[model samples]
Target: MEQFTEVFLEFINSWGYFAVSFLMALENACIPIPSELILGFGGYLIFIGKMSFSGALFWGMVGGLVGSLFAYYVGKYGGRPFVDQYGKYFLMKKSHVDSAQHWFDTYGISAVFFSRMLPVIRTFISLPAGFAGVNLYKFVFYTILGSLPWTALILYIGMALGENWQVLRTIGHEVSIVFIILMVIVVGILYFRRKQKR
Candidate 1:
């Protein structure tokens, strides 16, 4: 995780805002690139006067919108049946995939909006949204709305942290671990409950 953060930081440092957009697109694509570090570093650049807050924020949001398209298409076309067959090879579980769909169905707009600030949920909410046959305009609209707070907060923190932006790298790593554990627990509960019902 640390290495990933460093690699992304270097990549962005070299290419400026383009790297921000590119990497963020990949992150939203569900590639696990950690937007906290990406946008935070963008903020740090703003602090140093190398990039503007608006540029970083705009490109970051654009990248998220573009990146999410990949998952959306995959879900729209391939769907649960497709993921069910191939997911294990990629270390994904059917339960995890289904959970996203369940949440989107159950929570509606709030799910999409709040999930954007969460760790794993934020990364994956789009796929489920796609699976649920959400309208394209609605999906894009809420995705942007859902994305704004995190991007702005991380960028602002990165700007404030300046040379210390790497602090967020550590936080991002920890947050990911916690979310993984949380998912495992949720899955376990769902499994046991299903068993008892049977």
Candidate 2:
């Protein structure tokens, strides 16, 4: 993991703001790329005079918007058939899909806005919005509103932490991995227990 981190740091350091923006966008698009790492390391770079903070934030926001829109469209046009067929591959269940759809129906665009702050939930939230046929304009507006702050917050954290930013990056990565593992375990346990009950 340390070696991989070093390699990633080297790559980003060499590539500069463009790499940060690309990684941020890919991460937002449900690609499992850690936005925190990009932002934090970018911040450290700013501290070291390797990159500009404003440039980092600007590109990060652009990447986030692009990636999120990709997910939104995938969910919207692909429909439940795609979800039902491929969701399990992504650790999603039919009930989870149904629940997200229900949430979108009940909460509307607000759900999209709020879901942006959640960890794992944020990745999948767009699907329900798409499946529910939420207005594209409203979806984009809410998504950007929710996502920009998230992108900015992480990037700022990166900028602020500077040389010691790796501490936060490590913590964030561990937390994300643990969260994903726990979610899978909990979901699997619930699924089997529910099957037994039924």
Looking at model 2, residue 157 earns an lDDT score of: 69
lDDT of 1 by residue, 44-129 (tens): 99999999999899999999989887778777888878767875665555666666677788898567776776776777777887
Question: What TM-score does model 1 achieve against the real structure?
Answer: 0.79
lDDT of 1 at 153: 77
Error in Å for residue 15 of model 2: 1.7
- How many backbone overlaps does candidate 1 show? 0
Least accurate stretch of 10 residues (summed lDDT) in model 1? 175-184
lDDT of 1 at 8: 80
State candidate 2's TM-score.
0.73
Give lDDT: candidate 2, residue 70: 77
lDDT of each: 0.79, 0.73
Q: Over the full model, what C-alpha lDDT does candidate 2 score relative to the true structure? A: 0.73
Clashes of each: 0, 3
